[model samples]
Target: MFEFCADPSTLETGPWFACYLTNGVHLLFYQSFLTVLLLLAITAPVALAFGFAGAAASRSHIAPLRWFGQVYTSMVRGVPDIVFFLFFVIALDQALEWINHQIRCPDWDEPIRQGANFTVCQAAKIPLSSSPQWVHEVYNFGVAVFTFAIVFGAFAANVLFGAMRAVPRAQLETAEAYGMTRRQSFWRVLVPQMWIYALPGLSNLWMILIKATPLLFLLGVEDIVYWARELGGSRTSQFAYPHPDWRLWYFLFLLVFYLAFTRVSEIVLARINTRLSRGQATMAGEAQRRAGA
Candidate 1:
């Protein structure tokens, strides 16, 4: 906070506004917006990769791998998202600590779970009990990212799997007739064409992913929502900055933020759809050709 903001008791509107916005916590609050964007940027590709692998495995000839992929893709739809978010963080965290406990606490033979408390040796503690604040934040962030990826990966798998199937079987047969093996045809023919079909579904998934970023709070990552709630509430005169409850204004800012981002996303996806449609056999491609002629 600025020196003028040190005592907000007598400050005029402009000075108070300046200090309130510049305060340390407010700075963190602003950065949390970037944190939301960063999570989406990092998670999208990773989840897509995971989805690709799952889709491929589901289509595999092998029984067990196919079953695993089917289960992975279906689980997201079957389980409620909020339930998954709440449960996965604790489950994943404990699972990580348990693995560490088994390796690091071999000499100590104590029940890992006693009543409601789960205990692991200090060595097994993630970010260790004595670690700095940043370590905790980083660990929490990692957990949030992993959770988001796992949940979204399943949805992506469903989209890609359908897209792969939408690729014309005749195209694959033509590749085979040219002496290409199944693997060769898949990479050279089917994979290339599936994107046209996949784009629509994946675009929808991207919108959902953007909307889902707010769930970062459920994972205990202090995200924009958390900050908005904290900063918008009434601040007593005893505090450095006294303000009436402004949650409505703060949330309105968030609403506009999402609306603008999603609007841009729609425009970008439209251009991509247009680019991908060119020369394809779809109606859109035919229209494009007619326009050019």
Candidate 2:
């Protein structure tokens, strides 16, 4: 960013290092860390919301809704997660583009699926072909985030569903005895108490989500993994900053990043668990009560 950085190639070793770190591409590489954070921030809540809905659906009095929830939760559990991540992003993208094609190119005569190729109208292309590179990156990242949320949501649903069931039946009965309807008992009694039981599963899911952030690169997002590969490869004489192969160091950085993330998540989740157990009937709650007394 300094005026001396006007000619990066001509700069001395110290100046070269300074300019290299301050270069526009390097800034983007750094911001990719924030992108990971943003994905996690958005995905966690969306996934949890989906989980709550799925868990509720599983216990619905209506047979079809219950079946839908049960199937969703169970199906994801048996499948490899990477398979779902790959399949969902492509499937969802094609599905959206296909729908757009039908609407945008109503007069087009070509079939969408001709052998291996899946063609859509120019107007139906996501972000359109004319859009900038960053737009394409963002579109891909959005798809990746949504896919991650959906797949993880199923696992979260299973955890939440079991946790909801684990809430003591007598608590619901007591609410009913006080003239509360089933729905009221669920909302006022059961839902409030299920968190203590759910915390452990949800905590594990959070760590998994943290580790999975790197998969954003696999989905074509220009995330840290993408940048690491780009910047870490040995630069030749043609590039201003020539360096030796550093993929090992790049991946090592990634490993440390994820480990740090998981550690932070564990500390935060533990604090949340303590807060949730403040007045509950679980072992943690009982311990807290004894300590307070």
Candidate 3:
């Protein structure tokens, strides 16, 4: 935003390009990258927690709990991710609004489902219509995060369940031999060892999660993909900085960004795998031991 940028029309090539990139809209575009990063940061751990719960439930002695967990992982994993994304966000949104409507507008109840329209009272609207623009954006982003977590969580649960099973039965038996209860053995022996087995699957899930960030656009969060399309479109002379269609260039930048991000993720996961491999019986652990020797 140089002072000379005031007259975008008269500005030369360098100044025009500089001003174009530094404008308010471009700033928003830049901020959208952080939004994507934040989504990953929040969704990963939440999804992992969900996975752990589901995995544990699946392994539970109680039939109902085990069946519930099995159904959850099987159902969510069986569905196509995009279909789940679309259906779940709308369904979850309506469910929340329906709950709010019941609570806030109990007396004034015109049927919620009017052929195709799902109507709720004004007070029951999430974030409320009168809230700031940022409130709406935050709410939408939150919904996207939740939707991502649920879908990905099921896959993560499957990975974790397998990992939990892969832990040698002898280890648990040894814990029991030492007078540990089943729960104690699970926490002290099984949980600690499952990560090494889970890491590979979890790493793959991480990469998928990275790729999946673009789906935020489908959920109405104006993420990097949304901004890229918006900013990269051809602009007419009526606009401050007219340009031909540059979506190809914008998408190329995204391609580079994802490649770089995934590369770093690979490096990090490798290091973590090495760390987890130490003193374990896996091939990776054996390699580490030999290397150390």
Candidate 4:
């Protein structure tokens, strides 16, 4: 901020605006963009791993394991993702704290639930109520990221399970005839070929994930949406720079950001699909071979 910013009321238009945008709050606003990217970077792979596990479990020969996997994948699909996000963060947090409380304060006489209130001993509080402010923020962001991964993972599992099934039965048969075991055939033939079938659904899931990043605001993470609402609210004479409401512009920027993110993802995924299809027997692969020849 400029030295002239000392007297915000005395500053002229450009100077006030300049100082306003350069303030510490604006730096936090900019960092929120990185937070969004961080969330995406962490969640995507975690969700994919969860999906892979779910899909593998759903295909298990053991009846109980298969039933559990099938139920998890199916029930998640039947419910709205946001509902799970809202419920799970609190539920998981409470579950963790309760378990911690039992171990850390076993002698405490008070029940965790006192009528409408769910209270735990101070020692058991996540991040320890004594921890720094940033610790709490980081803890909340972790919860949000985990919640997003779990909910989206189930959907990914569904798409991947179907994709795994879509790989031709004849291909597996051919691999077996070539002296491959069932497991060998699955890894060598089915797994490699299923990706093209999965790409379209996975692409759709990526777009949804991009859009869902805004829901971080609901989860108490100080994401771009949080900053947009905070920075764009009308500022009166009480604040450093007085301004009318600018929330619409802030939200519009968010809209453009998400649109660009998804657009780039679509282009990248398309290129990947093309590369993956080059030597396969699928329609796209066959078309490419014909064109090249």
Candidate 5:
């Protein structure tokens, strides 16, 4: 990044460190932090949508829908996250390729599953063999997003479902007495009030999701954890910039980053909870009313 970076070996302490930090590899490391943030940004809302759908499905009048939602939440909650992460990505990828193979390779007679290997025709390959590196990375990141969403969505669904049920029965009855349809009562009366109840659970889930970003390494997204380990390992003098094993420092930075992130999240969530609590019959609202009076 600097002209003095031409010979890193010739540089003094300050310049050496500066140039080392600004190198191409270090730039990637910096970018990995953004990758983690982007994952959280994209995953949170998508997972919330999934959770809402699942929660609504569980509460549906249709027996099949309710059963499916109940089963989804129960099954996912019971399974270990690592197991689901490993299994789901492969399964979802293969399922997509398999469907694509059927559509794009109907003329081929070769079996997709021979012994243990699952193979699809070149045309049906995800991103195709000729695609750019960025396309492959994007596809992998997308798979990671969906996997995170599905797993976290189940937990969110349980939280939301409980929140929905926590809304007072009297309120719903009153809405019905006023001639509001079930759907109208739910959307207009119940949903708005449920956030105060759901906020605590969702806040904790957000923290967990933040902690789980390291799992992106397993999904091939080259996340912060991956870069930390890569850059922190000792490099010999033959490399452009030699360094001793610094993984301890690297991980310490991660620890600090997460702690700060979660601390800020707590403050933000508290404010949101306070906002949602306003004018409601909940204890927080009642306390606010007393304080104001």
Candidate 6:
């Protein structure tokens, strides 16, 4: 900002605009875009992994495992997403603090719940009461990531559960005839084949997940949405950088960001769908064969 405009007060028009846009706070605002992307990148695969485990557990011969998977997958279906977001973050925070209290302050005899306050020993507070600002930010980011995984993982499990069942029963029978144990055939055969059937539903899920990234604000993570509203709100002339209510423009930028992201994703997913279709008996495979001939 200094290189662009030595004194923002002295500058006008072009130089002033340049310096204002490149201000330190604006830079942090730009970096929040990366924060959103990183959360998506980290959360998507973890959610998928959890979903896979849930789907497999649902199919397990063990009764307790099957019940757990069913309950987990069903848990999110009837709840409003916004309500769940608010409820889970608070619930998870308290749950962690309680566990920490149990471990860190075992000798303390006071009940944690006293009237409206849920207090733990100072040592048991997440990030501790004395930890630095960055520690708090990191902890909040972690909770946001985990919250996203749990909710989306349940939806992914349902999609995968259906996809796994869609695989031809004859395929599994053929694997068993070759003396493959249920677990062996499951890993080598069913898992490989399930994706072809699952891709459509999973692709929709990926898009939904992309749209859902903005919910990080509700979880108290300083995400892109948070910064956008902060930076674009009305700024008084008393401030170094004064501006009107420019929130409309800020939101327009986010709109374009998400649009470009989804556009690229659709292209990539289409390519992957084509690749996965090879040698399968789906209509796409038939079309590919006809095209080659």
- Assess each prediction's global lDDT (C-alpha) against the native: 0.91, 0.90, 0.94, 0.89, 0.94, 0.91
Model 3 poorest ten-residue lDDT run: 106-115
Candidate with better TM-score, 1 vs 4: 1
Over 162-230, each residue of candidate 5 has an lDDT whose tens digit, in order, gives 999999999999999999999999999999999999998999999999999999988889998999999
Taking all chains together, each candidate's TM-score versus the true structure is 0.97, 0.95, 0.98, 0.95, 0.99, 0.97
Question: What digit string (tens of lDDT, one per residue) describes model 2 on residues 1-293?
Answer: 77998878798899898998888888989999999999999999999998999999999999999999999988987788788877877888899998899899999998889999999889999879999988988888788778888889999999999999999999899999999999999999999999999999999999888878878877887789989889989999888778899889888998898888888888999999999999988899999999999
Off by over 4 Å in 6: 4-6
- lDDT per residue as tens, model 6, 130-187: 8999999899999999988988899899999999999999999999999999999999
Give RMSD to native, each candidate.
1.1, 1.5, 0.8, 1.4, 0.8, 1.1
Which regions of candidate 5 are displaced past 4 Å? none
Residue 263 of model 4 has an lDDT of: 83
- In candidate 1, position 283 carries an lDDT of 81
Q: Model 6, 210: alpha-carbon shift in Å?
A: 1.0
Instruction: Arrange candidates, best lDDT first.
Output: 5, 3, 1, 6, 2, 4
Q: Which ten residues in a row have the lowest lDDT in candidate 5?
A: 217-226
Q: How displaced is residue 116 in candidate 2, in Å?
A: 1.2
Worst 10 residues of 1 by lDDT: 1-10
Per-residue lDDT of candidate 4, residues 59-170 (tens digit): 8788998998799899988888778877887889899999999999999998889998989999999989889999999999899888888888998999889999998898
- Name the 10 consecutive residues with the lowest summed lDDT in model 4: 81-90
Runs in model 3 deviating more than 4 A are none
